[model samples]
Target: MGEQHGCQTCHGDTDAHVADPTMKNVLVYQAKGGSAVDELSAKCLACHDSDTHMAMWKMSKHSRNDISCFNCHTMHATRGAVDQPTKCFTCHRDIKVAVNKQSHHPIIENKIKCSDCHNTHGTATQHMIKDDTVNQLCYQCHAEKRGPFVWEHSPVEENCLICHSPHGSRHAKLLVEKVPNVCQDCHDWSRHPGTPYDANAGFTGSSPSNRFFARSCLNCHGAIHGSANFENHGLRQ
Candidate 1:
């Protein structure tokens, strides 16, 4: 049967298994005590090396970590392509939690797949991202943010991770921290650093000058990402 299907090409020397009909005689790619990861991966690469996506597998982080094809892929499985995330979530438990967060990409909704951002097989970019840079990868979907505005937020242009969390966050808009706190990371807050301005502060109308009244810094700096209008240098418009 191995020869009929050319399984031996990958399983290797299944002649002993054909003679003995036992697991011990067969080369199980993912068996706990069987061949080393390199030996197992070599079998997979032999057939997959020609694939454009898999071309970089040899240089991927997964390859360097001794992860084999069997680690993520299950041969002869009847599972659909959408089911792939379930296998990934098994190891990426942290990302599982992040995707479940209230504010997150539409991963759980199945509107998007992990492969949208990542080239799991391999990539020259860090984190196996499909694009050369994170911002470029994001621009694939958010073309609006791919702007050459007159006023630019330096960090927004440099790296999205500076203010936002790629996976998920408790804060709205996937912000790494809450509004004022996120802004305070770069802006100096010596004037009203730790002042507690809640609904009471606005209800009383006593501290209208406080920066923490409503949306905080965003109240004035509305165009936080960038602005097309030249007059909006403070990002207010």
Candidate 2:
């Protein structure tokens, strides 16, 4: 069948010819056992060696774990467009469940794909992110949040993951925790180094717990991350 169907006809060429000899190292593969499965996989890797993104796959966790290129992608288009978490979920079911929860990065709704945020090929970072910094990667989509404002929340500028789960979140607004506690994380009343506040009485009276915590604190304190207003009092901006 190799001659009848012409392996070269379907697979293009299998000979070793290089456009750039310097990239010779990219053709590395394991076919030691030399079975049909191993040989076929090695054949697929031949042409893929020319792709720069695939070159980085060698250093990835998935590569180390024996995940091959065909695991998530369909070069031949047999499995349709290969829906995002659907492909990823095939291996990571638990994470898929979490990613399908209440709030997330829109991957579930197909607004974005996992490959948009992650490099299936290897990266300097463990998660295979395309960039060196996590926040920098997130800023590609949330450009509005990327700012050098006079008042900056350290975590917002640092890593969005500190407060949000990039894949999915159970809480509203993609927060790791609910509002008041989420704000209280770094901005505890005691730790407000700018202008101190009274935490002695935790909202008593008939005021609803959720309303008091959510609005009262954030409303008066217009800018949770310290305002630039020169005339501002404590938090009454």
Candidate 3:
């Protein structure tokens, strides 16, 4: 029906992605599935591969396991970076348990994702790091703890993982264990706050000892480092 009246069907505007500078290299559509693994490799190598830091993934455990970009990332889903954890949980069921443990990062309630802490794409450092060290990675959120304080807690600086679980924990404040005992592990009576102890006042099955050993160190040092305000009796306010 050449030049037919009321004919509405028509071709769209000319494709400009290839010709437009701003549109150059913009992803239009992504392939799917293992059948397209070669295509996926080629597509990824266009930006990644030997020339980039991400080339390490060519021989990584994930690569050996056949974990690819599309396996964890969706090109155009309602779930983006903010929901990446849920996407990861689709395969890693243990992550669900980890994120739900008693003391977890605010990921679930805040809708933050695993990618927020762990960089999956690429980085200049190992582990596809967004930061140089584990503490630095944690400091991205716990900036208050990254202090050059007058009194530095060794464990606090050495490895937070020792006392905290990055995924989660069963104890309050993300503690690795119940207190008094947990503190006693390193702070025995001999090293009472890091000093020699007197046998005369040695820790025995006394009333005072029971009082002191009944609860976690946090029961009294609730504020811990945050406890700067002390009462007249030298107790945390």
Candidate 4:
């Protein structure tokens, strides 16, 4: 780890630069259309290839896209700059907006980081998520939703993305769609569920309040996720 294997290891043989003080003699990591991305990345992987977090770097989207470590990291910077999310937000502007939505994970608050759910170096899972499955990643924080209920909701069991948007959504509870509408996607729209409810239907209280007037389907079917009640198969409990 002396000068022979230190900065010169990546900077290339710099004896000529030290002797003559010429920029052309030293190897620069920047993308100047001179060196291929692989050539530049190889210098970084020389040391990082053995690190546990970097084991899957070759399979990562960044690597596939020709993004070198130098793109996001500055060798001269202090430790604080190396781990900050600000550099990430420069390229992931959309995620920055999504994280600021009314309902979102605590990324801005620093309680949760992008790395908490994602392996930037790469993973077998799509989106580079840390867990094998999306639901498994979510289960880390929402343990209550990881239940084996007596009567399980098909969407909840299959995938959380079926009803919720993982990033952010304007709808309440990060729902992909509004309450009754979201429920109606799979429910048979034959009777009460399909009926349109307007103020005119119950303005004078002559008719029972429509689904839209109250808390929608959830008013009665409180246990939408699942129901443990022995007699309440409809999730009324």
Tell me, by TM-score, which candidate is best: 1
What clash count goes with each model? 0, 0, 0, 0
Best by lDDT: 1
* Number of the candidate with higher TM-score, 1 or 2: 1
lDDT per residue as tens, model 4, 1-237: 333466687787788778887556456877783667887788777777665546778888988998888888776677675445677787888988887888877777888788888887788779999998989998999888877777777788888899998877778888988877787777644533434555566544323344433335675677766767745644564
The TM-scores, one per candidate, come to: 0.83, 0.68, 0.62, 0.82
Query: Could you give candidate 2's per-residue lDDT for residues 68-163 as a string of tens digits?
Result: 665666544676576677888888787687778898777777788777877776777858887888888987877767765566767776788888
* TM-score preference between candidates 2 and 3, better one: 2
Query: Superposing every Cα of model 3 onto the true structure, what RMSD results?
Result: 10.4
Q: List the residue pairs that clash in candidate 1.
A: none
lDDT of 3 by residue, 199-225 (tens): 677655434444544443554454443
Provide the global lDDT of candidate 2 against the true structure.
Answer: 0.63
Model 3, residue 195: displacement in angstroms? 12
Off by over 4 Å in 2: 1-42, 74-81, 193-215, 222-237
Clashes of 1: 0
Give one digit per residue, the lDDT tens place, for model 1 in 1-237: 223456677677788778877656445766484778887877777666667546788799988988888888776676585376687898799999998887898888888888889988889999999998999998888888878888888888999989988988888999998977787777655643545656655545335455433335775678877898867754574
Q: What is the lDDT of residue 75 in candidate 2?
A: 49
lDDT for model 3, on a 0 to 1 scale? 0.59
RMSD of each: 4.5, 8.4, 10.4, 4.1
Error of 2 at 20 (Å): 38
